[model samples]
Target: MTETNPTKVQLVQVDPELEGQRIDNFLRTFLKGVPKSLIYRVLRKGEVRVNKKRVKPDYKLQAHDEVRIPPVKVAEPQELPSVKLNKVANLEQYILFEDDQLIAINKPSGMAVHGGSGLSFGVIEALRALRPEQKFLELVHRLDRDTSGCLLVAKRRSALKSLHEQLREKQVDKRYHALVSGHWPASRNKVKAALRKNILKSGERMVSVAEDGKESETRYRVLQSFEQATLVEAFPVTGRTHQIRVHCQYAGHCIGGDDKYNDEVFNLAMQEKGLHRLFLHAYSLSFMHPKTGERQTLIAPLDPQLSQVLKNLSHA
Candidate 1:
């Protein structure tokens, strides 16, 4: 069934030139915020019809076609809870890349990507306050709350659209560094798997391979290895949610200090060794500039906690 804010409106006159136009395309010009996926859902459910007939997405609409639009039920915009700016004193320290159209930050552990689950504010809201005149600040991609480094933000709508297209086209290159809990078998390995999301009783997102799931891919090479763990560089080819963390676990090497996805006992052991935060960091991102049309690569250095984890783990 389709879930959306349905619009209840009387039939409007269609131009003569609009006759025989596809319903989906015609609706695009009139609607705002309803995703194309939702539109297809509406068509399939017969909420939108053409000339008293159940029309599919490809169905043509003639002039004066009486289209019945279901009552619009749009999701309301979430209000951002207030935050005390003084608490986030080091928020400025994370900025690593900035331009008129974009900005990249070395996002630290303990800061969320957005306000939810009782979080008062995320970095985006803080950044938005920093530049109120810009009118929009959008997250081009996401990094886990406890994972540090290289989070990209788009300053304008056009840049966000272009960069998102690049991601879909597989033109964006992303590389990460992670310290995992076991010695990998190969110097380099590729993990190709399908991942499905299942909600745990505790309300956290849990992922595993399922027959019906999204395809995820990761390529890794051992950079440093020790008695019980290894430091590796990971390159993700697809942007599925928690793609890297889930893939690492599927490979039998959960990332050190990953509380949500990693083994709990192993995580506690790492915590004893001063590895308190998630030992994963986005190291580099390369893409073509949206406005300049030039190739660009941005890098964010490892934070102290992750660096120390490597230092202490390599010797053990």
Candidate 2:
């Protein structure tokens, strides 16, 4: 794990592995135990500087750029509890691809990506424990906690930078398999709506379609239709929080087993059919190798339980 000296103002030079990382994310790692709100506050107040100039939270750091961090008290690092190690060992079996620059895993549903918000450990934390020798592992992108599928992790900083560029330019192709309530209209192949994110009083996050929200788009192709549900492929053109699930709801077909944006009666029906989790899986991803520029595509087959649900629906 990376460590920073917090007892005094320190100037650290960015390395190749951290190139193109957002300054705010970089600070979070450098200043472990500091709250995210404080990190943003520091950025807003110009207390954190890059090359002696204040930069926004989204400013990407370049190699050799000097970052000045002010002195701040951080909590003492805690030792990893023993039970977490056992959970991490299970992830070894899900590795779909691994190379010098990156690793791709078929992340399981119900597992958060990185620990926070009461989760003691997530995929990234477990991976870190599993590979203590790795110095620069980081998440390239994210998947919803209940959505299982192909997930990318960068082994080097340069690779992370390259992949971020691809995502920003929409050069990478991601596809998901989803089971939703109701019969989807054959002609309704695309959904374009603006989404705005909100936080409830309890700090829970939600998203809804709004006129003053960010533009979001999802392309849907019905793979199969049943009396009460439809199996479809979802291609999200813009990545927003809960984009696919919310858009499907907007189409009057909320994803099955989605408690946040789903119909309760429909969920009960899907549960009776053996659906135990959200029926959204990131089935495939296509992108250029950040190191070689060679195109690579990875696929994660549906979990057997999810497959069984589809079979049950098809036969019904």
Candidate 3:
């Protein structure tokens, strides 16, 4: 696909490969370096049109549909730092499973799933750079920057659609291993609460339990216990934003090392025990194969640093 010059009012025709994609996403790819807010603004003002008619951001494009884009200033594409390039190249070592339809990686902690919020590059961008020959690769779902494990990517549009459908139908099973700050009661196995996402004035995102929030559920089982912390497996029944972290906090045991939703005292105590990052790991994922009808389960082992932290706590 040819790149669109943001300085000009450009008209482009959608091809079959991009037929089902939302118009806003299509424009993002076409007008690289244009801010997302600007794109939406153009759409709202009718500066962007499909088939000569105004369309919503969610409007799916059809093959051969003509899209009109208005002139807008866009930032120039900048070269990624060599350090980031090297880090992204090393991502090949983390691949857990890969096939024609999808790929799963034991994503390392501290890497964002996709770049945007102050990050210049992320896993998806790095993967694209690593495999420049591949025309289509997209994230199936997201993981927190500090969370590590079975992150999925789609190799085909059909696979992406199928996996998304499975997620919506709750056919996908995702489980995480988390270490919390308090002794989790044996009888408290399930947490049924509602969560609402809020943005702070500083633009930081947070989640809280609220009566008007979307319904969310999480199942927890204690795996091990220390004097100050407990290791538990969390199954989030509803994938609301920060569901697992906030749910654990609501249950009176905030996840250890979770700076956003955890007690600072607990975080400091855990930090003294060699825990430097959030003690949350996406341990396993199960779902039906997008291409095949059979069920597939993928797992990622805990990072060595996290394992060492647990080992230290056990001896303490």
Q: List the global CA lDDT of all models.
A: 0.80, 0.91, 0.89
lDDT of 2 by residue, 172-259 (tens): 9999999999888889999999999999999999999999999999999999988889999999999999999999999999999999
Tens-digit lDDT string for candidate 3 (71-153):
98766766544534568878999999998888899999999998888998888888887777787899999999999999999
Q: Which candidate ranks first by lDDT, i.e. highest? A: 2
Clashes of each: 8, 1, 0
Q: Rank candidates, TM-score, best first.
A: 2, 3, 1
State residue 253's C-alpha deviation in candidate 2, in Å: 1.2
Best by TM-score: 2
Would you list the rank order by lDDT, best first? Answer: 2, 3, 1
Candidate 2 RMSD to the real structure: 4.0
Of 2 and 3, the candidate ahead on lDDT is: 2
Model 2 whole-model lDDT (C-alpha atoms): 0.91
TM-score winner between candidates 1 and 2: 2
Candidate 1 residue-wise lDDT, 273-307, digit = tens: 78888888899999999999999999999988777
The segments of candidate 3 whose C-alpha lies over 4 angstroms from its true place after superposition are: 1-19, 22-28, 33-84
